[model samples]
Target: MPGRVFLTTPVAEIAARFGLDPEPVANEPPRQNISPGQTVVALTPEGLQHMRWGMIPVGRVNARGRPVMETIVNARSETVFDKSAFAGTGRAVLPVDGWYEWTGERRRKIAWRIRSAEPGLLFFAAITDTWTAPGGQVVPQIATVTCEPNADVRPVHHRMAVIIKAEDVPIWLNGSEERAAQLMNPWPDGRLVVEAATGVDWSDT
Candidate 1:
Protein backbone atom coordinates (compact mmCIF):
# COMPACT_ATOMS: atom_id res chain seq x y z
CA MET A 1 0.00 0.00 0.00
CA PRO A 2 1.16 3.54 -0.73
CA GLY A 3 0.91 5.46 2.55
CA ARG A 4 2.35 8.47 4.37
CA VAL A 5 3.38 10.84 1.60
CA PHE A 6 4.73 14.38 1.98
CA LEU A 7 4.08 17.35 -0.31
CA THR A 8 6.55 20.20 0.19
CA THR A 9 6.05 22.19 -2.99
CA PRO A 10 4.13 25.45 -2.74
CA VAL A 11 0.69 25.51 -4.35
CA ALA A 12 1.78 27.93 -7.01
CA GLU A 13 4.50 25.55 -8.22
CA ILE A 14 2.09 22.66 -8.44
CA ALA A 15 -0.44 24.78 -10.28
CA ALA A 16 2.19 26.01 -12.70
CA ARG A 17 3.57 22.54 -13.38
CA PHE A 18 0.15 21.11 -14.21
CA GLY A 19 -1.17 24.24 -15.89
CA LEU A 20 -3.92 24.47 -13.37
CA ASP A 21 -5.86 27.57 -12.46
CA PRO A 22 -5.50 29.09 -9.01
CA GLU A 23 -7.18 27.15 -6.23
CA PRO A 24 -6.91 26.49 -2.53
CA VAL A 25 -3.49 25.08 -1.72
CA ALA A 26 -2.11 24.11 1.67
CA ASN A 27 1.10 22.52 2.83
CA GLU A 28 1.23 19.23 4.67
CA PRO A 29 -0.78 19.28 7.83
CA PRO A 30 0.30 17.92 11.24
CA ARG A 31 -1.08 14.47 10.69
CA GLN A 32 1.79 12.12 11.31
CA ASN A 33 -0.70 9.30 11.02
CA ILE A 34 -2.85 10.09 7.99
CA SER A 35 -5.04 7.08 7.44
CA PRO A 36 -8.09 6.42 5.33
CA GLY A 37 -10.88 9.04 5.17
CA GLN A 38 -8.39 11.89 5.21
CA THR A 39 -8.12 14.36 2.34
CA VAL A 40 -5.11 14.50 0.03
CA VAL A 41 -3.97 16.30 -3.08
CA ALA A 42 -5.13 14.55 -6.25
CA LEU A 43 -5.49 15.67 -9.86
CA THR A 44 -8.75 15.38 -11.77
CA PRO A 45 -10.44 16.68 -14.90
CA GLU A 46 -11.43 19.67 -12.81
CA GLY A 47 -7.72 20.45 -12.27
CA LEU A 48 -5.24 19.93 -9.44
CA GLN A 49 -7.51 19.58 -6.45
CA HIS A 50 -7.93 18.05 -3.02
CA MET A 51 -10.08 14.97 -2.49
CA ARG A 52 -10.70 12.43 0.19
CA TRP A 53 -7.93 9.86 0.25
CA GLY A 54 -10.35 6.96 0.31
CA MET A 55 -12.39 6.06 -2.77
CA ILE A 56 -16.12 5.79 -2.14
CA PRO A 57 -18.12 4.46 -5.08
CA VAL A 58 -21.09 6.43 -6.37
CA GLY A 59 -24.63 5.15 -5.78
CA ARG A 60 -23.45 2.61 -3.23
CA VAL A 61 -25.79 2.58 -0.26
CA ASN A 62 -25.78 0.63 2.95
CA ALA A 63 -28.88 -0.97 4.43
CA ARG A 64 -29.51 2.36 6.16
CA GLY A 65 -29.51 4.12 2.77
CA ARG A 66 -26.48 6.09 3.84
CA PRO A 67 -23.42 6.36 1.63
CA VAL A 68 -20.65 4.10 2.74
CA MET A 69 -17.38 5.73 3.70
CA GLU A 70 -14.83 3.82 1.69
CA THR A 71 -11.70 2.87 3.60
CA ILE A 72 -9.63 2.03 0.55
CA VAL A 73 -6.62 4.33 0.34
CA ASN A 74 -4.65 2.34 -2.22
CA ALA A 75 -5.68 0.38 -5.29
CA ARG A 76 -3.64 -2.03 -7.36
CA SER A 77 -3.08 -0.66 -10.82
CA GLU A 78 -3.32 -4.05 -12.50
CA THR A 79 -6.92 -4.59 -11.40
CA VAL A 80 -8.21 -1.07 -10.75
CA PHE A 81 -10.19 -0.71 -13.96
CA ASP A 82 -11.36 -4.30 -13.80
CA LYS A 83 -12.90 -3.53 -10.41
CA SER A 84 -16.35 -1.99 -10.35
CA ALA A 85 -15.40 0.87 -8.01
CA PHE A 86 -12.86 2.27 -10.46
CA ALA A 87 -13.79 1.08 -13.95
CA GLY A 88 -14.08 4.46 -15.65
CA THR A 89 -12.03 6.47 -13.15
CA GLY A 90 -8.76 4.56 -12.99
CA ARG A 91 -6.31 7.21 -14.07
CA ALA A 92 -4.94 10.24 -12.22
CA VAL A 93 -1.85 11.76 -10.56
CA LEU A 94 -1.06 12.16 -6.86
CA PRO A 95 1.86 14.54 -6.48
CA VAL A 96 4.17 14.28 -3.49
CA ASP A 97 7.58 15.38 -2.34
CA GLY A 98 8.28 11.94 -0.89
CA TRP A 99 6.83 9.04 1.09
CA TYR A 100 7.52 7.24 4.36
CA GLU A 101 7.80 3.50 4.94
CA TRP A 102 8.85 1.17 7.72
CA THR A 103 11.79 -1.21 7.71
CA GLY A 104 13.95 -2.91 10.35
CA GLU A 105 13.81 -5.87 12.72
CA ARG A 106 10.38 -7.47 12.54
CA ARG A 107 9.84 -6.81 16.21
CA ARG A 108 10.61 -3.10 15.89
CA LYS A 109 9.81 -1.17 12.74
CA ILE A 110 11.93 1.83 11.82
CA ALA A 111 10.78 4.50 9.42
CA TRP A 112 12.50 5.74 6.27
CA ARG A 113 11.82 8.35 3.61
CA ILE A 114 11.98 7.79 -0.14
CA ARG A 115 12.03 10.72 -2.55
CA SER A 116 12.27 11.29 -6.26
CA ALA A 117 15.71 11.49 -7.80
CA GLU A 118 14.85 14.45 -9.94
CA PRO A 119 14.95 18.04 -8.74
CA GLY A 120 11.19 18.68 -8.90
CA LEU A 121 8.12 16.92 -7.55
CA LEU A 122 6.97 13.35 -8.09
CA PHE A 123 3.58 12.26 -9.38
CA PHE A 124 2.14 8.90 -8.44
CA ALA A 125 -0.61 7.06 -10.30
CA ALA A 126 -4.04 7.50 -8.81
CA ILE A 127 -7.76 6.77 -9.41
CA THR A 128 -10.54 9.20 -8.52
CA ASP A 129 -14.36 9.16 -8.26
CA THR A 130 -17.23 11.20 -6.88
CA TRP A 131 -19.85 10.25 -4.33
CA THR A 132 -23.20 11.81 -3.45
CA ALA A 133 -24.60 12.02 0.03
CA PRO A 134 -28.20 11.31 0.97
CA GLY A 135 -28.78 15.08 0.94
CA GLY A 136 -27.58 15.38 -2.66
CA GLN A 137 -24.14 16.61 -1.62
CA VAL A 138 -21.25 15.51 -3.84
CA VAL A 139 -17.78 14.53 -2.59
CA PRO A 140 -14.74 13.63 -4.63
CA GLN A 141 -12.19 11.02 -3.65
CA ILE A 142 -8.97 9.40 -4.82
CA ALA A 143 -6.72 6.38 -4.16
CA THR A 144 -3.10 5.95 -5.06
CA VAL A 145 -2.23 3.02 -7.34
CA THR A 146 0.59 0.61 -6.50
CA CYS A 147 2.66 -2.01 -8.27
CA GLU A 148 5.55 -4.39 -7.50
CA PRO A 149 8.61 -2.92 -5.81
CA ASN A 150 11.49 -1.48 -7.74
CA ALA A 151 15.14 -1.87 -6.68
CA ASP A 152 15.36 1.22 -4.50
CA VAL A 153 11.99 0.39 -2.96
CA ARG A 154 12.25 -3.40 -2.65
CA PRO A 155 14.42 -3.34 0.45
CA VAL A 156 12.01 -0.90 2.05
CA HIS A 157 8.63 -2.15 0.94
CA HIS A 158 7.09 -4.77 -1.30
CA ARG A 159 5.04 -2.23 -3.25
CA MET A 160 5.58 1.24 -4.65
CA ALA A 161 3.40 3.87 -6.24
CA VAL A 162 2.94 3.70 -10.03
CA ILE A 163 4.95 6.74 -11.10
CA ILE A 164 4.42 8.02 -14.62
CA LYS A 165 7.17 9.70 -16.58
CA ALA A 166 6.58 13.24 -17.83
CA GLU A 167 6.70 12.09 -21.45
CA ASP A 168 4.05 9.50 -20.72
CA VAL A 169 1.95 11.57 -18.33
CA PRO A 170 -0.68 12.31 -20.96
CA ILE A 171 -0.80 8.71 -22.07
CA TRP A 172 -1.08 7.43 -18.53
CA LEU A 173 -3.62 10.05 -17.56
CA ASN A 174 -5.79 9.75 -20.71
CA GLY A 175 -4.77 6.68 -22.64
CA SER A 176 -6.25 3.27 -23.34
CA GLU A 177 -6.46 0.85 -20.41
CA GLU A 178 -4.06 -1.57 -22.06
CA ARG A 179 -1.53 1.17 -22.71
CA ALA A 180 -1.70 2.67 -19.23
CA ALA A 181 -1.41 -0.68 -17.55
CA GLN A 182 1.76 -1.28 -19.50
CA LEU A 183 3.39 1.69 -17.76
CA MET A 184 2.53 0.59 -14.23
CA ASN A 185 5.66 -1.40 -13.61
CA PRO A 186 8.22 -0.78 -10.85
CA TRP A 187 10.54 2.13 -11.53
CA PRO A 188 14.02 1.30 -12.77
CA ASP A 189 16.39 0.21 -9.95
CA GLY A 190 18.70 3.21 -9.85
CA ARG A 191 16.11 5.88 -10.47
CA LEU A 192 15.81 6.52 -6.70
CA VAL A 193 18.20 6.64 -3.78
CA VAL A 194 17.45 5.62 -0.20
CA GLU A 195 19.07 6.88 3.00
CA ALA A 196 18.62 5.00 6.25
CA ALA A 197 17.66 6.86 9.42
CA THR A 198 17.61 6.29 13.18
CA GLY A 199 13.85 6.11 12.81
CA VAL A 200 10.95 7.36 10.65
CA ASP A 201 10.48 10.85 11.99
CA TRP A 202 10.13 14.00 9.90
CA SER A 203 8.92 16.25 12.71
CA ASP A 204 12.42 17.49 13.41
CA THR A 205 12.96 18.44 9.81
Candidate 2:
Protein backbone atom coordinates (compact mmCIF):
# COMPACT_ATOMS: atom_id res chain seq x y z
CA MET A 1 0.00 0.00 0.00
CA PRO A 2 1.38 3.45 -0.93
CA GLY A 3 0.15 5.29 2.15
CA ARG A 4 3.01 7.76 2.07
CA VAL A 5 4.70 9.21 -1.02
CA PHE A 6 7.04 12.00 -2.02
CA LEU A 7 7.48 14.15 -5.09
CA THR A 8 10.59 16.32 -4.87
CA THR A 9 11.03 17.04 -8.56
CA PRO A 10 9.86 20.40 -9.84
CA VAL A 11 6.47 20.67 -11.52
CA ALA A 12 7.99 21.90 -14.75
CA GLU A 13 10.32 18.91 -14.87
CA ILE A 14 7.46 16.52 -14.33
CA ALA A 15 5.41 18.13 -17.10
CA ALA A 16 8.36 18.09 -19.47
CA ARG A 17 9.03 14.43 -18.75
CA PHE A 18 5.44 13.56 -19.65
CA GLY A 19 5.17 16.10 -22.46
CA LEU A 20 2.43 18.04 -20.70
CA ASP A 21 1.84 21.72 -20.22
CA PRO A 22 2.72 23.14 -16.80
CA GLU A 23 -0.27 25.35 -16.18
CA PRO A 24 -0.01 28.18 -13.67
CA VAL A 25 -1.03 27.18 -10.18
CA ALA A 26 -0.70 28.77 -6.79
CA ASN A 27 2.17 26.47 -5.92
CA GLU A 28 3.51 23.03 -6.84
CA PRO A 29 6.44 22.63 -4.51
CA PRO A 30 8.23 19.42 -3.61
CA ARG A 31 6.44 17.25 -1.07
CA GLN A 32 8.25 14.50 0.77
CA ASN A 33 5.47 13.18 3.04
CA ILE A 34 2.16 13.26 1.24
CA SER A 35 -0.62 11.38 3.01
CA PRO A 36 -4.21 10.49 2.21
CA GLY A 37 -6.64 13.41 1.88
CA GLN A 38 -3.84 15.62 0.61
CA THR A 39 -3.85 16.89 -2.96
CA VAL A 40 -1.51 15.05 -5.34
CA VAL A 41 -0.73 15.58 -9.01
CA ALA A 42 -2.15 13.10 -11.51
CA LEU A 43 -2.22 12.59 -15.28
CA THR A 44 -5.77 12.21 -16.51
CA PRO A 45 -7.50 12.21 -19.91
CA GLU A 46 -8.41 15.84 -19.28
CA GLY A 47 -4.73 16.67 -18.68
CA LEU A 48 -2.59 17.06 -15.56
CA GLN A 49 -4.49 18.03 -12.44
CA HIS A 50 -4.31 17.78 -8.67
CA MET A 51 -6.74 15.30 -7.07
CA ARG A 52 -7.40 14.03 -3.58
CA TRP A 53 -5.46 10.91 -2.70
CA GLY A 54 -8.47 9.01 -1.34
CA MET A 55 -11.73 8.02 -3.10
CA ILE A 56 -15.31 8.33 -1.91
CA PRO A 57 -17.80 6.15 -3.73
CA VAL A 58 -20.69 7.93 -5.31
CA GLY A 59 -24.29 7.54 -4.07
CA ARG A 60 -23.16 6.36 -0.66
CA VAL A 61 -25.45 7.81 1.98
CA ASN A 62 -26.26 7.30 5.64
CA ALA A 63 -29.59 6.51 7.27
CA ARG A 64 -30.11 10.20 7.83
CA GLY A 65 -29.50 10.88 4.14
CA ARG A 66 -26.13 12.54 4.76
CA PRO A 67 -23.18 11.88 2.51
CA VAL A 68 -20.97 9.10 3.82
CA MET A 69 -17.35 10.01 3.41
CA GLU A 70 -15.65 6.72 2.70
CA THR A 71 -12.03 7.25 1.97
CA ILE A 72 -10.59 4.34 -0.03
CA VAL A 73 -6.90 4.93 -0.57
CA ASN A 74 -5.89 1.73 -2.32
CA ALA A 75 -7.65 -0.71 -4.62
CA ARG A 76 -6.67 -4.31 -5.17
CA SER A 77 -5.74 -4.62 -8.83
CA GLU A 78 -6.87 -8.24 -9.07
CA THR A 79 -10.51 -7.47 -8.27
CA VAL A 80 -10.83 -3.86 -9.34
CA PHE A 81 -12.67 -4.80 -12.51
CA ASP A 82 -15.29 -6.90 -10.76
CA LYS A 83 -15.74 -4.48 -7.89
CA SER A 84 -18.82 -2.34 -8.38
CA ALA A 85 -17.14 0.81 -7.12
CA PHE A 86 -14.40 0.69 -9.74
CA ALA A 87 -15.94 -1.26 -12.59
CA GLY A 88 -16.30 1.48 -15.18
CA THR A 89 -14.57 4.52 -13.75
CA GLY A 90 -11.81 6.34 -15.61
CA ARG A 91 -8.16 5.48 -14.94
CA ALA A 92 -5.32 7.79 -13.88
CA VAL A 93 -1.56 7.74 -13.26
CA LEU A 94 0.10 9.19 -10.20
CA PRO A 95 3.68 10.39 -10.74
CA VAL A 96 5.54 9.63 -7.56
CA ASP A 97 9.24 10.07 -6.83
CA GLY A 98 9.16 7.30 -4.19
CA TRP A 99 7.08 5.61 -1.52
CA TYR A 100 7.56 4.64 2.14
CA GLU A 101 6.97 1.35 3.93
CA TRP A 102 7.69 -0.14 7.35
CA THR A 103 9.19 -3.41 8.58
CA GLY A 104 10.33 -5.24 11.75
CA GLU A 105 8.37 -5.77 14.95
CA ARG A 106 5.63 -3.33 15.79
CA ARG A 107 7.59 -1.97 18.76
CA ARG A 108 10.78 -1.42 16.75
CA LYS A 109 9.53 -0.90 13.24
CA ILE A 110 11.81 0.75 10.69
CA ALA A 111 10.89 2.96 7.76
CA TRP A 112 12.20 2.34 4.25
CA ARG A 113 12.13 4.47 1.13
CA ILE A 114 11.53 2.75 -2.20
CA ARG A 115 12.37 4.35 -5.50
CA SER A 116 13.02 3.39 -9.12
CA ALA A 117 16.54 2.29 -10.05
CA GLU A 118 16.53 4.52 -13.11
CA PRO A 119 16.08 8.26 -12.91
CA GLY A 120 12.73 9.93 -13.58
CA LEU A 121 9.24 9.20 -12.19
CA LEU A 122 7.45 5.99 -11.31
CA PHE A 123 3.84 6.20 -12.45
CA PHE A 124 1.39 4.36 -10.20
CA ALA A 125 -1.77 2.98 -11.80
CA ALA A 126 -4.88 4.39 -10.14
CA ILE A 127 -8.68 4.67 -10.46
CA THR A 128 -10.66 7.85 -10.00
CA ASP A 129 -14.23 8.74 -9.00
CA THR A 130 -16.47 11.75 -8.70
CA TRP A 131 -18.55 11.77 -5.52
CA THR A 132 -21.59 13.83 -4.88
CA ALA A 133 -22.92 15.06 -1.56
CA PRO A 134 -26.49 15.76 -0.55
CA GLY A 135 -25.82 19.45 -0.67
CA GLY A 136 -25.09 19.34 -4.38
CA GLN A 137 -21.33 19.31 -3.86
CA VAL A 138 -19.10 17.23 -6.09
CA VAL A 139 -15.58 16.06 -5.21
CA PRO A 140 -13.05 14.26 -7.35
CA GLN A 141 -10.96 11.60 -5.65
CA ILE A 142 -8.53 8.79 -6.54
CA ALA A 143 -7.08 5.55 -5.16
CA THR A 144 -3.81 3.86 -6.08
CA VAL A 145 -4.04 0.29 -7.35
CA THR A 146 -1.94 -2.38 -5.60
CA CYS A 147 -0.76 -5.86 -6.48
CA GLU A 148 1.25 -8.70 -4.95
CA PRO A 149 4.79 -7.69 -4.09
CA ASN A 150 7.66 -8.72 -6.29
CA ALA A 151 11.04 -9.95 -4.99
CA ASP A 152 12.25 -6.40 -4.45
CA VAL A 153 9.28 -5.39 -2.27
CA ARG A 154 8.17 -8.67 -0.65
CA PRO A 155 10.65 -8.39 2.23
CA VAL A 156 9.26 -5.03 3.21
CA HIS A 157 5.55 -5.61 2.59
CA HIS A 158 3.13 -8.07 1.09
CA ARG A 159 1.83 -5.61 -1.46
CA MET A 160 3.12 -2.76 -3.59
CA ALA A 161 1.65 -0.09 -5.82
CA VAL A 162 0.90 -1.16 -9.42
CA ILE A 163 3.47 0.81 -11.43
CA ILE A 164 3.00 1.52 -15.14
CA LYS A 165 5.83 2.37 -17.51
CA ALA A 166 5.83 5.81 -19.08
CA GLU A 167 5.47 4.40 -22.57
CA ASP A 168 2.28 2.55 -21.54
CA VAL A 169 0.54 5.61 -20.14
CA PRO A 170 -1.64 6.01 -23.21
CA ILE A 171 -3.00 2.48 -23.03
CA TRP A 172 -3.50 2.64 -19.29
CA LEU A 173 -5.58 5.79 -19.54
CA ASN A 174 -7.54 5.15 -22.74
CA GLY A 175 -7.68 1.42 -23.17
CA SER A 176 -10.65 -0.69 -22.15
CA GLU A 177 -10.83 -1.89 -18.56
CA GLU A 178 -9.73 -5.34 -19.64
CA ARG A 179 -6.68 -4.00 -21.40
CA ALA A 180 -5.82 -1.72 -18.50
CA ALA A 181 -6.06 -4.54 -16.02
CA GLN A 182 -3.40 -6.38 -17.98
CA LEU A 183 -0.85 -3.78 -16.84
CA MET A 184 -1.58 -4.27 -13.14
CA ASN A 185 1.26 -6.64 -12.42
CA PRO A 186 4.12 -6.27 -9.98
CA TRP A 187 7.09 -4.21 -11.00
CA PRO A 188 9.99 -6.48 -11.94
CA ASP A 189 12.76 -7.08 -9.41
CA GLY A 190 16.15 -5.28 -9.70
CA ARG A 191 14.30 -2.26 -11.06
CA LEU A 192 13.70 -0.74 -7.62
CA VAL A 193 15.99 0.63 -4.91
CA VAL A 194 14.82 0.10 -1.35
CA GLU A 195 16.87 1.59 1.51
CA ALA A 196 16.63 2.56 5.16
CA ALA A 197 14.87 5.87 5.55
CA THR A 198 16.99 7.76 8.04
CA GLY A 199 17.19 11.51 8.54
CA VAL A 200 14.77 12.10 5.70
CA ASP A 201 12.46 15.05 6.24
CA TRP A 202 9.49 16.03 4.12
CA SER A 203 10.73 19.58 3.57
CA ASP A 204 14.39 18.67 3.04
CA THR A 205 13.89 16.58 -0.09
Candidate 3:
Protein backbone atom coordinates (compact mmCIF):
# COMPACT_ATOMS: atom_id res chain seq x y z
CA MET A 1 0.00 0.00 0.00
CA PRO A 2 1.06 3.66 -0.36
CA GLY A 3 3.20 4.51 2.67
CA ARG A 4 4.44 7.92 1.62
CA VAL A 5 2.95 10.63 -0.62
CA PHE A 6 4.50 13.57 -2.48
CA LEU A 7 2.63 16.68 -3.52
CA THR A 8 5.01 19.25 -4.91
CA THR A 9 2.15 20.97 -6.74
CA PRO A 10 0.78 24.08 -5.10
CA VAL A 11 -2.43 23.79 -3.14
CA ALA A 12 -3.92 26.59 -5.19
CA GLU A 13 -3.45 24.58 -8.34
CA ILE A 14 -4.98 21.54 -6.74
CA ALA A 15 -7.97 23.57 -5.62
CA ALA A 16 -8.40 24.99 -9.10
CA ARG A 17 -8.23 21.54 -10.70
CA PHE A 18 -11.14 20.38 -8.53
CA GLY A 19 -13.19 23.52 -9.31
CA LEU A 20 -12.73 24.82 -5.77
CA ASP A 21 -12.13 28.43 -4.81
CA PRO A 22 -8.39 29.05 -4.51
CA GLU A 23 -8.79 32.31 -2.60
CA PRO A 24 -6.89 32.75 0.63
CA VAL A 25 -4.61 30.04 -0.59
CA ALA A 26 -3.44 27.68 2.11
CA ASN A 27 0.28 27.61 2.81
CA GLU A 28 0.94 24.02 1.82
CA PRO A 29 4.60 23.79 0.98
CA PRO A 30 6.06 21.36 -1.51
CA ARG A 31 6.14 18.09 0.38
CA GLN A 32 7.93 15.04 -1.06
CA ASN A 33 7.64 12.75 1.92
CA ILE A 34 4.23 12.90 3.62
CA SER A 35 4.09 10.07 6.12
CA PRO A 36 1.35 8.67 8.33
CA GLY A 37 -0.18 10.88 11.03
CA GLN A 38 0.64 14.01 9.03
CA THR A 39 -1.96 16.23 7.40
CA VAL A 40 -2.49 15.58 3.67
CA VAL A 41 -4.25 17.54 0.98
CA ALA A 42 -7.66 16.11 0.19
CA LEU A 43 -10.93 16.95 -1.55
CA THR A 44 -14.03 16.24 0.46
CA PRO A 45 -17.71 16.68 -0.31
CA GLU A 46 -17.53 20.12 1.25
CA GLY A 47 -14.35 21.29 -0.54
CA LEU A 48 -10.59 21.01 -0.69
CA GLN A 49 -8.81 20.85 2.67
CA HIS A 50 -6.13 19.14 4.74
CA MET A 51 -6.86 15.97 6.68
CA ARG A 52 -4.61 13.79 8.77
CA TRP A 53 -3.27 10.83 6.77
CA GLY A 54 -4.18 8.17 9.30
CA MET A 55 -7.36 7.34 11.19
CA ILE A 56 -7.07 6.41 14.88
CA PRO A 57 -9.57 3.64 15.51
CA VAL A 58 -10.63 4.56 18.99
CA GLY A 59 -14.07 2.99 19.40
CA ARG A 60 -14.09 0.92 16.24
CA VAL A 61 -13.97 -2.85 16.20
CA ASN A 62 -13.07 -5.55 13.71
CA ALA A 63 -15.17 -8.31 12.16
CA ARG A 64 -14.45 -10.46 15.16
CA GLY A 65 -15.67 -7.67 17.43
CA ARG A 66 -12.24 -6.93 18.84
CA PRO A 67 -11.15 -3.34 19.27
CA VAL A 68 -8.93 -2.05 16.51
CA MET A 69 -5.85 -0.63 18.20
CA GLU A 70 -3.70 0.49 15.30
CA THR A 71 -3.80 3.61 13.22
CA ILE A 72 -5.09 2.92 9.73
CA VAL A 73 -3.21 4.55 6.87
CA ASN A 74 -4.86 2.50 4.12
CA ALA A 75 -8.02 0.45 4.07
CA ARG A 76 -8.53 -2.52 1.79
CA SER A 77 -11.11 -1.82 -0.91
CA GLU A 78 -12.60 -5.31 -0.70
CA THR A 79 -13.75 -5.03 2.93
CA VAL A 80 -13.92 -1.29 3.35
CA PHE A 81 -17.63 -1.15 2.75
CA ASP A 82 -18.56 -4.23 4.72
CA LYS A 83 -16.22 -3.91 7.67
CA SER A 84 -17.82 -2.80 10.88
CA ALA A 85 -14.54 -1.21 11.84
CA PHE A 86 -15.05 1.30 9.04
CA ALA A 87 -18.66 2.08 9.75
CA GLY A 88 -19.68 5.74 9.87
CA THR A 89 -16.61 6.88 7.96
CA GLY A 90 -17.01 9.52 5.28
CA ARG A 91 -15.25 9.56 1.90
CA ALA A 92 -12.72 11.88 0.30
CA VAL A 93 -10.08 12.14 -2.42
CA LEU A 94 -6.37 12.68 -1.75
CA PRO A 95 -4.67 14.33 -4.72
CA VAL A 96 -0.94 13.95 -5.15
CA ASP A 97 1.91 14.07 -7.64
CA GLY A 98 2.80 10.48 -6.71
CA TRP A 99 3.49 7.96 -3.95
CA TYR A 100 6.39 5.80 -2.79
CA GLU A 101 6.62 2.03 -2.42
CA TRP A 102 9.42 -0.12 -1.09
CA THR A 103 10.85 -3.50 -2.02
CA GLY A 104 13.71 -5.89 -1.04
CA GLU A 105 15.07 -7.07 2.28
CA ARG A 106 14.66 -5.34 5.64
CA ARG A 107 18.16 -3.79 5.67
CA ARG A 108 18.57 -3.18 1.95
CA LYS A 109 15.18 -1.91 0.90
CA ILE A 110 14.78 -0.12 -2.41
CA ALA A 111 12.44 2.79 -2.93
CA TRP A 112 10.35 3.36 -6.05
CA ARG A 113 8.34 6.41 -7.01
CA ILE A 114 5.05 5.85 -8.78
CA ARG A 115 3.18 8.54 -10.61
CA SER A 116 0.73 9.00 -13.41
CA ALA A 117 2.22 8.57 -16.86
CA GLU A 118 0.28 11.56 -18.08
CA PRO A 119 1.32 15.09 -17.15
CA GLY A 120 -1.03 15.71 -14.26
CA LEU A 121 -2.06 14.69 -10.75
CA LEU A 122 -3.46 11.43 -9.43
CA PHE A 123 -6.33 11.10 -6.88
CA PHE A 124 -6.46 8.36 -4.29
CA ALA A 125 -9.83 7.19 -2.97
CA ALA A 126 -9.98 7.70 0.78
CA ILE A 127 -12.12 7.39 3.92
CA THR A 128 -12.55 10.12 6.48
CA ASP A 129 -13.46 10.42 10.16
CA THR A 130 -13.36 12.81 13.09
CA TRP A 131 -11.79 12.06 16.46
CA THR A 132 -12.46 14.08 19.59
CA ALA A 133 -9.51 13.98 21.93
CA PRO A 134 -9.32 14.27 25.74
CA GLY A 135 -9.84 18.01 25.86
CA GLY A 136 -12.53 17.93 23.17
CA GLN A 137 -9.99 18.69 20.48
CA VAL A 138 -11.51 17.50 17.26
CA VAL A 139 -9.13 16.04 14.68
CA PRO A 140 -10.22 15.07 11.20
CA GLN A 141 -8.38 12.11 9.73
CA ILE A 142 -8.33 10.06 6.52
CA ALA A 143 -7.07 6.79 5.11
CA THR A 144 -6.38 5.94 1.49
CA VAL A 145 -8.08 2.95 -0.07
CA THR A 146 -6.09 0.17 -1.74
CA CYS A 147 -6.63 -2.53 -4.32
CA GLU A 148 -4.54 -4.95 -6.34
CA PRO A 149 -1.78 -3.22 -8.23
CA ASN A 150 -1.90 -2.65 -11.97
CA ALA A 151 0.59 -4.12 -14.39
CA ASP A 152 2.96 -1.22 -13.96
CA VAL A 153 3.04 -1.37 -10.16
CA ARG A 154 2.68 -5.14 -9.74
CA PRO A 155 6.37 -5.71 -10.34
CA VAL A 156 7.24 -3.50 -7.40
CA HIS A 157 4.33 -3.95 -5.01
CA HIS A 158 1.43 -6.33 -4.59
CA ARG A 159 -1.06 -3.56 -3.86
CA MET A 160 -1.52 0.06 -4.90
CA ALA A 161 -3.72 2.93 -3.84
CA VAL A 162 -7.18 3.05 -5.40
CA ILE A 163 -6.69 5.91 -7.80
CA ILE A 164 -9.88 7.45 -9.07
CA LYS A 165 -9.88 9.35 -12.36
CA ALA A 166 -9.98 13.14 -12.48
CA GLU A 167 -13.41 13.03 -14.06
CA ASP A 168 -14.66 10.65 -11.37
CA VAL A 169 -13.46 12.68 -8.43
CA PRO A 170 -16.94 13.95 -7.76
CA ILE A 171 -18.31 10.43 -7.59
CA TRP A 172 -15.62 9.41 -5.18
CA LEU A 173 -16.42 12.33 -2.96
CA ASN A 174 -20.22 12.52 -3.11
CA GLY A 175 -21.57 9.40 -4.76
CA SER A 176 -23.27 6.54 -2.96
CA GLU A 177 -21.19 3.77 -1.46
CA GLU A 178 -22.16 1.36 -4.25
CA ARG A 179 -21.23 3.96 -6.83
CA ALA A 180 -17.92 4.70 -5.14
CA ALA A 181 -17.09 1.02 -4.95
CA GLN A 182 -17.35 0.89 -8.73
CA LEU A 183 -14.49 3.35 -8.96
CA MET A 184 -12.06 1.47 -6.73
CA ASN A 185 -10.40 -0.51 -9.51
CA PRO A 186 -6.73 -0.05 -10.23
CA TRP A 187 -5.47 2.47 -12.74
CA PRO A 188 -5.18 1.13 -16.29
CA ASP A 189 -2.10 -0.82 -17.29
CA GLY A 190 0.81 1.37 -18.39
CA ARG A 191 -0.92 4.48 -17.11
CA LEU A 192 1.60 4.62 -14.26
CA VAL A 193 5.35 5.03 -14.47
CA VAL A 194 7.46 3.68 -11.62
CA GLU A 195 11.11 4.68 -11.35
CA ALA A 196 13.82 4.20 -8.76
CA ALA A 197 13.69 7.00 -6.24
CA THR A 198 17.15 8.62 -6.42
CA GLY A 199 18.97 11.55 -4.82
CA VAL A 200 16.01 12.89 -2.82
CA ASP A 201 16.48 12.35 0.90
CA TRP A 202 13.96 10.03 2.65
CA SER A 203 14.81 11.46 6.05
CA ASP A 204 11.82 12.02 8.34
CA THR A 205 11.85 15.76 8.27
Using TM-score as the measure, the top candidate is 3
Q: What is the lDDT of residue 205 in candidate 1?
A: 38
Which candidate's lDDT is highest?
Answer: 3
lDDT per residue as tens, model 1, 135-159: 9988887888999988899888988
Candidate 2 total steric clashes: 0
Q: Quantify all predictions' global Cα lDDT against the true fold.
A: 0.73, 0.85, 0.90
lDDT of 2 by residue, 1-205 (tens): 8879988888888778777887942278888888888888988987788888888766644446666567789989988877655655678999999999999888898999999999878999999988676798777788999999999999999999999999999899999877898899999999999999876774542
**TM-score of every candidate relative to the true structure:** 0.81, 0.88, 0.96
- By TM-score, the better pick of 1 and 3 is 3
Name the TM-score of candidate 3.
0.96
- How far does residue 178 in candidate 3 sit from its true spot (Å)? 1.3
Ten contiguous residues with the weakest lDDT in model 1: 26-35
* CA shift of 134, model 3, Å: 2.1
The residue pairs in collision within model 1 are none
